[model samples]
Target chain A: MKPHTLSVLVENRPGVLSRVTGLFSRRGFNIESLAVGTCEEPGMSRITIVVIGDDAKVEQVMTQLHKLIDVIKVSDLSENERVERELALIKVNAEPGTSRAEILQIASIFRALIVDVGSKSVILEVTGDTEKIDALEKLLRQYGVKELVRTGKIGILRGSKSVPGSK
Target chain B: MKPGAKILVESLPREGTEIIFGYPGGVVLPIYDELYDSSLRHILVRHEQAAAHAADGYARASGRVGVCLATSGPGACNLVTGIATAYMDSAPIVAITGQVPTNLLGNDAFQESDITGITMPITKHNYLVKSAADISRVVQEAFYIAGTGRKGPVLIDIPKDVSTGLAEDTPLPEKVTLRGYNPTYKGHKRQIDKAVELIVHAERPLIYAGGGVIASNASAELVSLATLVGIPVTTTLMGIGCIPCDHPLNLGMLGMHGTEYANFAVMESDLLIAIGARFDDRVTGKIDTFAPHAKIVHIDIDPAEIGKNKRIDVPIVGDVKAVLQDMLSGLKKNNAYEPWLKKIKHWKQHHPLRVKDDGRLHPQYIVRALSELVKGEAVIVSEVGQNQMWTAQHFCFHHPRTWITSGGLGTMGYGFPAAMGAHFARPDVPVFDIAGDGSIQMNIQEMSTVAANKIPVKVAILNNMYLGMVRQWQELFFDRRYSFTELPPVDFVKIANAYGIDGMRVDSPDDVVPALKASLDCNGPVVMDFRIEREENVFPMVPAGAAINEMIGGHPRS
Candidate 1:
C-alpha cells in the first residue's frame, strides 16, 4: 500500500471534525494518522491526513473532498516535501538507588526532557516518529512506568503553496 | 398607526422556511388572517405538541431548518413538546409564535405568554423579534445557525408589533456571520496512518455506520470502501439508510432492537470501524463486552464521541466522505478471505428474525407485509416501541436516506409528523409511518398537518392497546405485572375523520394490502390502524446490562 498524505483546508466550525471523521467512519475507512490546526488564515484550519491506498483511490477521495462546501482545498501531499512530528509524554518509576542516572542518560540520548522529578517517579517528554516514541516507552516500562499520554500525531506539507483544495 | 387589531400579513413561498406548526387562538387572529391569504401554507393542528413534531419531522427529513408557527399562551405552551422533541433529536427547526401586541406584552395579558423562556432549553438558540426590520435577519440567522454546525432547532417569538410594524426589509436574503462557529471538514494525516496500519493488520474488521452518513451524503463513499475492503457493515438505527440493505456485506441494524445476526457480528468481529455513529447504549448493549475482540477505529465528525462510548485503537476525526476517501487511498485490497462475512451469512440464515405464531395478528407481520408491499422503496418513519423495533427488523431499506426515525432521542409521537416531513422532502416517493397505538397518540394531532398540507403520508398504526416495548420488558423481567403499559385506546378512524383525513382499521391479514393501498391512494393523509393482537412482542431483545448476544427472547406471558 502506498502511503499518501492529504492537506485539507476547511472552515473552522463546531462539529466540523465530527462531520469529517463521520465521513471516513461511515465509509469504513481506517484512518492511519490525523492532525488538525489553525492555518495561516483566520476561521480556517488545515487538516493533515496520512492514509494508505492507491493513487486512483486517493484522487477519488480528493474529488469528493473538493465537493464539500466547507472544504476549501484537498491535496495529496505525499509527494510534497513535508515535515511530520509526534509527541509523547511518559512517566517511569525511578527507584531510590537503582539506575536513576542510567534513565536520565537514556533520556539525554533521545533528546527527551525530564519534565517531572518526584522521589519515586520521573516524567519524560519525548518527540519523534511513532516507532521512536514506542521504543522509548517500551524501554522505560522495565523501570515500572506509571502513566503515559500521547497526543494524536500532526503533520504539515513542506513549502507554502497552501493545500490545493483549501478555500 | 392602525387599530391595535390590525390584521398583519406575511406572504412566503415553500423554498426556505424555518418554522410554522402550531394552533392560533383568539388574540392570534391577525397572524392567522395573514396566513390565510399567504402562499406560505399553515398547518392548523389539534394540539400544539403535534406542531413541534411536524417541524422536527421537516427538519430531520430535509436537512434544512424546519418552520413551525403557533399563537400565544396555551398554543405556544403546547408547542413545547415538539420543540423539546426537536431539541433532543438535534433537528434544525425554527418555531415562530404570534404574540399579543406590544402593549399587552407584560400586562399578565389575556392569551399572552413568555414563550421564549419556555422554549429556551429546548432550542440551540431563541429570539424574541421586537422590530420588524429584525424579523427577516433574525429568521435568516435562525435558519443559518439551526441548519449549520450541530443542526438543531431555534425558536423565534414574534410579538404582534413586529408582525404588523411596517418595516421594509425584504422577508429573505441576508448574510449573518458568527465569530466562533466554524466546523472542520479536513482530517489529519497522521491519524489516518495509524488507522490504516491497524486496518491492514486486522483479521476481523467491522464497519459501523451511523446517521451522519446520510447527513453528510456520504453513502456512496461508504459503499465504495465497504466493497473495496470486503468489510462487514452494521448500522445504528439512525444509520439505516447509509448503505442499502440488499448489499451482500450488510449486517442489518445493530442495537437493543437490532437483529441477532448483527449483534453477533459486532461481538465477534476483530476490528470495529465505527463511522459517523455515536455508540448509543442501545447499539452497544454492554460496552465492555461489545466488540470485545475488536480493535475499534472510531472515525467521527465529533471528537467528544470518540472516547465517550468505547475506547479506540485508531481515532480518525473528519468528515466521513473525505476520510473514507483517504482511507480508501490507503487500501491494498488485502481482504481476500471473508471469514466474518461467511460467519454472519451463516448466522443470518440459521437464526433469521421470526414472529410468534399463535393464530394472532402480529406487528412484525404487518411490518414485513409493509416492507414487501413498499418493496423497500418508500421512505419509512417509525415511532418508538415494538413498532420501531419491528420496522427495523423487517423493513429492507434499499436506498440511503429512505429510512427516517428518531434514533438518538427515541422520541415517541415522532413517526407521523416525521413522515409528513419526509414526504415534503422527497415529494415523489410515498412515505409511511409504522407506529404503535400508544406512540401514535403522543402526536396524533399531526393528523391535521398531513390533512392541511395535503401530504399523502400513509400511517400504519399497530394498535396493540399497550406500550409494546415496555410491556414486552415487563413480561420478560417483571413477571407480566403489566402496569400502566395498558392504554385506553381511541377510535383512530373517527379521529381521522374529525381532521378531514381518511383511515381504515384492519383486524384480518386479508385487509392488509387493501388498507395499505387505500392509504397510499388517498390524495391527502390516511391512517390504517391494524388492530393487531395486544400481546405481540419484538424479539431478540438484549437483556439489561448484559452482553449483546445475551438476548432474552420475547416469550408470551400468561
Candidate 2:
C-alpha cells in the first residue's frame, strides 16, 4: 500500500470532519488514520490524513479533496521536510497494588503521563512517533492493558514556508 | 490578430497539437470564436468529460500529445474526473480551461473557480496564464512536460482577460528546464548481467509484462525475448497485447479476474522476471506472500516502484524495450525449458476457463465469439464491469494498443468516447466497444458526437439490466442483497435512434453474430444490446481476502 499524507486547511466548522471523511468513504478510499485541530489561523482548522495508495493515485486523492468546497488548501509534504507525531492513551491492570510501583517506574522511563489511578488499575498517556508509541504500548501490555486509544499520524512542513507555487 | 483567444490559438501548434476536442460554454465564448477559421481544428464533443477521454484515447492510440479545451466552471469541473483518470494511467494530455475574468476570479463570480490550483496533483505540471505573452511559451512547456519520459496530463488555466489580451510579438520557449524533473532511460550494466545470470540458472522462469510494453512499443522485443529463452509470459490487464495471444508461450492475463493457468504459473514459478509491471495488490494478492518462491528481477522505468511492493533481487531501472534489447544481446538463445513448458501446458489443458455447460448465453462466450469474429485484428474498447474482465479473460489480442479499457481508474462510461478516439486515429480498421448497460448510461451523451463525426464504432452493451460485476459479488458474498445494482431498463434502441444511429437488441444466442455484423454493416455509429443472463458470475474468481493462487478453482477448499 502507498503511504500518503494530506495537509488540509478547513473552516473549523461543526461537521467538517464528517464532510471531509465522508468524501473518502464515498470514493472507496478509506482514511487509515486522521488528525484534526485548530491551526495558526483563527476560525481555521488543519486536518492531517495519512492514506494508503500509489503516489500517483494519492495525488489524485488530494486533487479530489481540493475540489470539495470546504477545503481551502491541500498539501502532500515531502518525507524529509515534514515532522510527524501521534498520541496514545492506555488503561492497564495494576495487579491489585503489587505491580503499581513497577508500572510507574516503567512509565517514567518512557516519560508517560499518568492520567488516572486506582487500587487495581492506572491510565497512562504516551505521545511520540508511531514506533515509540507502539513500544510503550507493548510494554504496558505486560501489565494487562484493558483499553487503548491512539491518535493517528499528524504532520506539518518543518521549514517556515508553505508549499511552493501556492498561496 | 485578436488578443486573448487568438494568442492561445497560436500557442497550439508550438505545443505540437494539430487538433483538440472540446465543448463551448458562455465563459469560453472568446476562445471558441477565435478557434473558428484557425489552423487548429477543434472537434466539438457532446460532453466535457468525453473531450478529456478522447484526448487521452488519442494520446494512447498515437504516441503523441493529446489536447482538450473547456470553459469554467462546470465544463472545467467535468474534465476533472477524466483528467484524474488519465493522471492515474499516465496518459499525455494538455487540458486548457477558460476561466472568468481576473477581477471576478476570487469573488465567486459567475463561472469562476481556481481550476489550475485544483488540478495541481493530478497533472505532471500546470500553469496559470496571467498574461497573454506567457500563453505560447507555457503551452510549449506543457507539451514538453506531458510527452517527456513518464508521460502524464498537464493543465493550463487561462483567465478570460489574458486569453483576449495582446502584447507585442510572443515567442514560444525553445526548451523547458525544471530543477527537479529528470527521468533515467539507460539501465546499469551490472543489473543486466545479474538478470541474465538468474535466467540462465532458473528451472521454472516466467516473464510478467505490463502496459510499459505498449508505452515503449516493445512487443517485438518482448516476443523475441520470450522465444529466445523459451519462457512463458503472463501479462497484467494493461499489458494485454505485448505478445500474440496465440503464441505458444503466452499464459494470458494474471490478476483478480485472470485465467486459472496464468495465476497458477505465476505462483509456481521459480524465477520471476517482472518487466514494466508493478506488483499491484490486485495483481499480487498479498504483497508479502506474492511470488514467495521466486527470485525477482524487476525492470521498470520508475525507480521508486522497484522495491515498493516486493523485495527485489535484481532491480534494473530502464525502459522496457531498451533493457530487453541489452539482455537479448548478452544472452544465448536456449530452448532448455521444454520440460517446464510441457508441464505448464498440461496444467493449462487440465484447468482451463469453464462456463456452465447449459444452453444459456454466458458473458465469456460472447467475448470469445467477438474475439474470434474480429479475428484479433480490431481495437477493442471495454466498459467498466464484468464485461471488461470477460474480455480480458477471453479476447486474444495480437497487437499492442489493440485493447483499451479504463484499467487504472476503471471508469464506467469510458468505452464509447475512447472508441471514438481510437477510430479517429486508425479509421481504416474496425473498432468495437464491449459495453455494459450501467456503464453505457454514464456517458450516453457521446452518441451524438459519434453520429455527427460519422465515426463507425460498433458498441455491444451487455444488457443484464444491472451493474453486473457488483451484482456478481453481491450474489456470492453479500447474500444477494442487490441494492443499487439493479437498473430500470431503458430502451437503448430508442436512445440510439434518437441520436440518429441504428440500434438493435439480441435475446437469443443465435442472434449474437448476426447482430454484431448488422451493427458493423451500418454506415455510421450503431449500438447492439445483448440481453445476457443476470445471475452469471465471473467464474474462477479469487475469493476476496484470499491469496492470489488460492482461487475458487482446482485448489483444495479452505
- Output the number of the lDDT-best candidate: 2
Residue-level lDDT of model 2, residues B331-412, one tens digit each, is: 8888778888988898788777776547777777778878878888788988888889888888889988888888888899
What C-alpha lDDT do the candidate models reach, one value each? 0.76, 0.82
Q: What DockQ does each listed candidate score? A: 0.02, 0.04
Off by over 4 Å in 2: A1-167, B1-4, B173-175, B355-357, B553-558
TM-score, structure 1 vs. true: 0.71
Model 2 per-residue lDDT at B99:
88
lDDT of 1 by residue, B1-558 (tens): 321222223322323752366677765666676666566656666677777777777666667767777778888887887777776656778777778777787788888888876665566667766676666666667777677645677777777766667656454554566443445566789888888888777777888998777766788999888888888888888788778888988888887877788888888888898988887888888888999998888887655456666778888767878888898899877655477677778888777788666667787878888778778678888898888888888888988768777776678887887787777777888889999999888878778767877879888999988988889889988999998999887799999989898889899877877788777777778888899988877777888788888876732311
lDDT of 1 by residue, A72-151 (tens): 77777667677767898888999778978879988998899999999988989999877889889888888888999886
Point out where model 1 deviates above 4 Å.
A1-167, B1-15, B25-37, B99-114, B166-175, B356-359, B497-500, B554-558
lDDT measured at residue A112 in model 2 versus the true structure, 0 to 100: 94
